[model samples]
Target: MFTYVMRFLFCLLTILPLSLYAAVGDHFYYADWYYEILSETDMTVANLGARSASTPGLVYPTVEHNNKVYTVIELRKESFSSSYTFKNVDFTNYAPSSYKIKKIGDDVFNGTAIDPNTIPPCIEEIGARNFADRNDITSVTLPSQLRILGSSCFQSCANLQSVKGNFHLKKIGDGAFFMCQKLKTVELSYSVEDIGNDAFVSCSALESLIMPSAKTLGTGAFQDCPKLTSISLPSNLVSIGESAFLYCTGLKSIVIPENVISIGKRAFEHCDKAEYILFKPATEPAYVNWKGEAANFTDCFNADIESKMYVPSRKTYEHGIEMISFEDKPLTYTGLSPEISWKNNTPWPITVDTSNLPKTAGEHNVTLTAAFQNPSISLNIPYTFNIVKAPLKVTVNNSERVYGSFDQNYSCSFEGFVNGESESTVKLDLSYVTEANYQSPVGTYPISATLTPANYEPEVISGTITITKAQSTLEIQNLDELSNLKTGEGVIICWISNAPHSELSLGSETTASVELQKMSTLTNGEEAIQYRLIPINPGEGKVGLYASGSHNHEDAYTEFEVKIEDKAGITNVHTDCVSLITRPYEAIIIGKADNAKARLYDINGRLIHNGIDNVIRVAKRGVYILIVNNSRYEVAL
Candidate 1:
C-alpha cells in the first residue's frame, strides 16, 4: 500500500495545484527566498543580463509572449518550476553567506524549486524528495563527500539530463532519479554497492551503466530502461531483485558470473532481443522470487529464448615438436601450458595446467591437463619431445707464399657453434689438400678442406693457395775498395739476381771499361754474371748496373766509382783484395820511385804499424787494415 501511495503521488504532482505552487518556489535567491515579490514592473528592462538572478528558475523564459501586463514576472512558479507563466517583475539582490552545510533534513526542499547545483560541496547527504518534481535542474552533481543519495531526491525531475557521481558514494536510495527521461549514461564510481528499488526506473534515455562494484540491485531498480543495450553485472553481485531489468529490450548478450547464485523472477522478462545468455556456474542459478515463490531460470526469459538455453563443453590437443640444443633456444614453463592447443566449442575460455611439462632439453614423457569449472570437465593426455644436435661449417682460410718458398702453415675457423660450445668438445679430422708443390709455377691453386666430426654434422668451404713470383735483386760485388787501379790491372765485379735468365746493363762512363767474364743460372731461380772493370783514364765517374727480372716481377740497380793512377807503380801488390797465402797481412815491397812509401793503420784510422820502404803492415789475424800510399786501401786480413 505504501508503494502504491508513492507512485500515486508521483503521478498526481505532474499537474501541480496552486497551493503546491506557492510552496515549491520557496528557494533562496542569494540568501533570501526566490518567491519574494518585488514591486510590479510596468516598465521593461532592456538588458536582462544585468538582472540579479542567482537562483535557478528565478527568471526562466524571462522575455516571451506569456508575459502579461498586470501580472508581475514572478521568478518562481512555486510548483513544478518552469510551468511557463512569466510576467515582468522586479528582482532584488541579497547578501550571500559563507555558511557550511553538513546534511539536508528529509523533505527540507521536497517538491520545491531547489537547485541541485546550488547545494554546497560541504553537504554529505541529500534528504528524500529534496529536488523532486523540479523542471529547472538539467543535471545533478553529487557532493564530493556525499555517501548516501536519499530516496526520490531527484525523482520526476523531467529536465534532468545527467548525473555526475564521485567515488565516495556508497548507495543510491529508492526512486532516486526516477522518471528522468533525458539521462543517457549512468557511470557511477565503483565504490557504489547498492542500487535501491526503482532507483533509475523509467530512465528511457539511459543507454549504458558501469557500477561493477555493486553487490545487490533492488526490485524495479532498472525497470523500463529500454535504451540500455549493455550492462555489466558486477562480479561481486550476489543477487538481482525482481523486475530489475523487466522491460529492457535492446540487450544482445548476458553473462552471469559464478558468484550469482540466484536470479529473481521476471528480472529479464521482456529482453527478447538478447541472442544468448552464458552462465559461468556449472548448474543453472535458482530463479525463485525472494518471496519464496517457485520458478525456473527459463521462466524469466521471453518466449523467443525459452528453447535456446543450453550448456556445452570444449576441445584441446597435446603434442610436441623436434628441436636442437645447439640452436641456443631454451624452454621454460609458463603455467598456461602452450603445448595443449585448445578448441573451445562454447562462448567462454578456460585455462590449462602445465605442472607436468618439461623445463629442459631432452627426450621426455609429459602430460597436459585442462579443467573447466562451469559445466565441470577435465582432460588429460600424454606426449613426447626430443632435442638433437645442430649442423656446423668449418673453413680453412686462404694461404699465400712465394713460388720457390714452402709454407705448410694452413689455418682454419668455424661457424654455427652455439651455447658457448666449441671444437674442443668434439673430435675432428680436418685435412686441407692442394695440387701445388714448393716448386710450382706462380699461379692460384685451389685448396679443398674437409672436416669429419664425431658428434656433429659438418660442411666445408674450399680455399686457395697463391704462388707469388719472388722479388729479384742485382748487386755488383768486389767494388767496395776498387780504387786507384793501374792501367794494366783489372778487378772482377760479380753480379747476381734472384730471377733466372735476368741480364744486367751498365751505363756509359769515362773512367772505366768492363769486359764480360762469365754468366751462370742456378736451379733455385738465381742468375749470376761476372764483369772485369779496367781503369782506362784518370778522370773519375760513376757507372750504373741495372737488372731486369725473368719471371716479369723483379728489378734491381747498383752504382760504383772507379779511379786510375797516372803514374806507373810497382807490379800490382793488393790494392783491392788477395788470398792469405799470396798477400799476407804484412806485405813488403820496394818501389823504383824513392818517394813511394806505404803506411798501415787500424780500421779507426789510428796508426798501428808502418813501413817506409813501400811495405804495408796489416793485422796478422782477420782484423781490418787501411794501407796508405798515395791513396788509402781498406784490406781485411
Candidate 2:
C-alpha cells in the first residue's frame, strides 16, 4: 500500500507544472532511487534527476540521473546556483550523434550539460567561451540585429563554413571569429571600414579583396594573405597604414587612384609578383621615401648617338639639360648658276636659288636640321640669304643752332649713301622747345634730334642743358632779413649757388668767396642796419654786397641804404676785436632820423665815402661811419 501511495505521489509530481526555483532545498529534489526521465518541459533532461522545486522561466540544468543532481537557473532571474551531481540526464539515445539540445522555455534552450546539439536560433549574442572548441556548428545564422560578435564567439569552430547574415553588424569584435579555419567565405557589411590588424591576417583563403572607402587602413590588415592578386584603391583614401597588405605575394598589379595621397611604408613591400605599379598622373609631388620626403625620378628615356652632334655627357644630363649654338658661314656659288638644293642631309627637303647673282657679291641660303638622337628622328630648319654691298656713308646734318634765352633750337642735315649708280640721303634734325625762360630757368631743358630722309625713318634723341641766372652778388634789403642769421648763417652764406662761385661777394668785402664768420649787426637810430660780410677766401680787394645773394636769399632781400663817413668822427663805434670789420673799413650806418646827416673822410683827409649809390661806395674799405644822421640816404654813385 505504501509503494502504491509513493508511486501515486511521483506520478502527480510529474503531471504538475514546475515553478522557478532559487534555494537547493526548494528545487524539486528526490531520493537517488526516485529519478525520472520525463520530457514534460520539452527538455531531454526534464526530470533526469529529482529536483526540490520547479522554475517559471527557462530552466537549463545539467541533469545526470546516475548522480541524482540538477543545476538549474531561471532565465528571468538575475542569480541562481547549480547542483554538484545528476543522473539519467545523458542523451544516450543520440550518443555520438551530436543532438542533445532541447527547448525548455520560450526562445530558450539549455546546453544543459551542453550535449553537442543545435543551439536554439534565438541565441543572438553568444557569451564568451560559449562554444569555443565546438566543431558541431558547421554553419550558424547569427541574429540579424546582432551588431557585435563578442570575442571567441565562434573561435576554433573548425566546422564553421560560413557566417549567416549578420546584416546590422558594424564590427566583428576582437577575436570574435578567430581561428575558425573553415570560414572561407564572408559577406561583410558595407559599413565595416576598419578590419582590425591581424583580424584577417591569416585568412589565407582570402584571395581577392575590395576595401571600402575608408580613409586609413589599419596595420597588418591583410598580412600574409599570399593569394591576393590585384586591388583597386578607393578614390577618397589618403593612406594605407603600416603593413596593410604586406606579404600579399601573389598580387600582380595595383591601380593606386590619384586620390590616395599616401601609402605607408611596407604596405605592399612584400607583394613580390607585382610588376606594373600604376598610379594616376600626380598633380603634386607624389612618391614619398622612408623618411617622408618626396621621390625624384618622374620619367626616364634612353639615348642613341650618330657622328657630329652627340648627346651631352652623362654628368651634364644628370645636373640639367645641355644646349649648343651652331655658326654657319655664307656658302659660295663657284659653279655657274648652280641650283642650291640640300638633299638627304635632313629628314625634310630645302632649296635656294643663286641664279640671278652679281659678279662681285654672292648670295647663299643655309639650312639646319635638328635630330632627336634617342629615337633617331630629324627635321629640316630654314634661313634666308644676303647679297654683299659697299658700306654706306652716314653723317649727322644740322650741326649747330644758336638758342635764344627763351627760344627753341632747330637744325637739320643728311647722310650721303653712294652706290655709284643711285645715291640715297638720310637727313637729321635737332629741334625742341625750351621748358622755361632760360635766363636760365630753375631746371634744365632737353634737346632732341630727329632723323629723316628717303631711306631712314624719323627718329629722335635727347640731352639736358641746365638754365640759371648770372652772377654771385648779394642784395641786402633790410636789417630784419639778417635777424634770424645764427652761427650756421656763415656756413649758408659760404656756398651761394645759381651764381658765379668765383665772382661771389658780400657786404663790403670783395673776394673769390665770402663767409660772414662771427658776424653781428648793429643799428644806430635805424634807417638800415650794417652787417660786415667777412671774406674767408680772399685776394683782398674792395668789399661790397652784390645783388644776387640778397635777391635770392630766403628773405629775398632787395637792397640797403646808408651813408659812409670818416671812422674817427663816428660815435658808438664798437668791436671787441680790431680787424673784425677791417677797421677804418667802409662804415655802414642807417639814417639817424628821417633826414639823417652823414659824411665820409679817409685818414688822409680825403672823402672816398659817399651816398652816391644809396649804397655807401668806398674806393678802399676801412672803418668808417655809416651815418644815418644825414638826410635820408639816397644812391650817390
Candidate 3:
C-alpha cells in the first residue's frame, strides 16, 4: 500500500504544472523540488521568483536518484500568457543536445534531463562541461547574473557564431569557447577580470574582441585566431601568459603599457604579421621569459625581419667620435689616436690599424683593437672614416703702364693652383684687359682687372698709370697781317722752334719737311728760326706747321692763313648777313642762307676752310673770309 501511494504521488507530480511548485527563499532551489518534477521530460516553463539574498538568482544543484547523480543543465526565465499558459523560453539554446529548465513568471520548472542513452557512459557528471562540447549549438546568450564560467564550458562548439550577455561576469575558465571556428565577434562584460588558457583558441573567424577590465591572459588564450585583427587589453594588466597570441597572424602591432612587468615565453610566437612591439618602459623589463636562452621580449616575434622593438632610452654599446667634412682631405693619425672606451669605463690599451685606410677621397672602414692591461682580454671594433678633397688657392698679379699718344692694347694674367698642383692655364678668366682713355690724361689713374680660375675664387688687382707733359715748344714769326697774293705767288714767313725738325701742310696736301737751323739768341734766350710760305692755287686755305720728336720731347704746332685773288668773273654773288667767332680751341662760321659755296683763308693763301653749307667748322681763332663765286667778304674770329 505505501509503494502504491508513492507511485501515485510521483505520477501526479510529473503531470502537474511547474508554477505550482513553491519558491524557497527568493531564487528557485531545484534540489528542494520534488524528484518527479526534476525527472520530467515536458516541464518547459519555470519561475525563479524574486532574486535570493544568499544566491541572488536561480540556483543549479546536483540531484541524486537511485545510484546515479544528475547535474543541473541550465536555469533561465520564460514567457507566459495572461491565463498562465506555458509560453516559449527566453534563454538561447546554444547547445541543442543539452536539456534546459525555465522559470515561468515566478514559478520554476524542472525540465527533462539529457537522454542517458545518447550521452557517453564514461561522462558521469553531465552539465556545464557537457553543454560546452555539444555539437548542435550555433549561438548562446550567457546569463547576466553568472560570475564565473566553469572550465571547458564551451569547448569545441565548432559552429557557434555569436555570444551575448555576461554583463556581470568576472572570470572565464580554461578551454572555454575553444575551437569555435565560426565565432566572429565577442563583447566581454566590463567586470571580467581573467581569461583562462586556450580560451577562444582556433576561432579563425573571430575578428573583433573587447576586454577592457580583464587583467590576466592565460596561455594560448587567443592563439590561432587568424582573423582576430585588433583587441584592447585592460590598462591595469601586468603580465601575459605563454603562447597568449601564438599564430595570430592578423595582429599587426601592440603596445606594452607602463605597468606591465613580465611576459611569458612564446607569448607572441608565430604572429607572422606583427611588425611593431612598443614598450612604455624607458629601459628593458626585469622578467621577460619569451626566449629560453636570451629571453628578450622581442624574441617572441620569431626573428621576423620586419618586426622591431622601440625603447625610449638612448643607451647603446658603442662609444667613439664620428668625423665629417665637406673637403676630401686625408685624416691625420693624431686626430684618431684616442683609446677605445667601454660603457663600464674600463681602461684598456688601444691600437688602430690605419695603414689599410685608402688614400683616395671616399668613405673607408678601418679595424681597431683594444686589449686589457693584463693582456688576457681583447676586443676589435670596426670604424669608418671619410676623406674629401681640400680647398683651392688663387692669386692675381698687379699691373702698371705708361700713357702713349694714341690708343693701345694691354693685358694682365693670373695664376691658380688646387691642392698644391697648378691648374690648366685655359681655365683662367680675366674681366678686362685695357684701360679706357689711356692716352688722354697726364696724371695718375686707377687701372683694374679680375682673374677667375675654374675651381677657385676670383682675384682682382688694381694699379696706377702715370702720364707727363711733353717738353719741346715752338713759335711763329714774320709780318702779322700777311694778306693778298697772286694765284701763283709765294710769301715769306718765319718760325722759331726748339725741336729737331718741323713738318708743314697746306689743306690736305702731303707734308713738307723743315730742318731746324741754328740762329742767334732772341729776347728770352730762346733759339729763333725762319721759313717761307707759298700759295700755288687761286683759293683760300691755311698752312700748318708742327714740330715732332720722341716721347721725351713735347710736340709744338702753329698755323697761319693766306688768300689768293680769283681771276674768274662773278656769277651769283650777293650781299648777305654773315657771322663768325673764333676761340683759342675752335672757330664758328654762320651764313644767312643755305647752299652758298664759301672759302676761308688766313694770311697765307692756303685754303684752310671750304664748305658748301651755311656753317663751317675750323681749328684756330683768326681773321677769315667768305668768298662766294668771285666776291670776297672779310670776317674776324
- Residue range 312-410, candidate 1, lDDT tens digits: 221110111111011224333221222433344443344556564553334666554545565344434334444333567778789887644667778
| Candidate 1: clashing pairs of residues | 25-78, 73-87, 73-88, 73-89
lDDT of each: 0.53, 0.38, 0.45
Ranking of models by lDDT: 1, 3, 2
Candidate 3, 519-587: lDDT as tens digits = 211111112222222223446656455555122333455554534334321111222211111222321
Per-prediction TM-score to the true structure, in the order listed: 0.38, 0.31, 0.33
lDDT agreement of model 1 with the native: 0.53
Model 3 superposed RMSD (Cα)? 23.0
Task: Provide C-alpha RMSD values for all models, in order.
Answer: 23.4, 23.0, 23.0
Q: Which scores greater on lDDT, model 1 or model 2?
A: 1
Q: Mark the regions of model 2 whose C-alpha exceeds 4 Å error after superposition.
A: 1-146, 156-168, 177-186, 213-220, 232-246, 254-270, 276-441, 445-543, 546-637
Off by over 4 Å in 1: 1-100, 281-284, 292-294, 303-342, 347-637
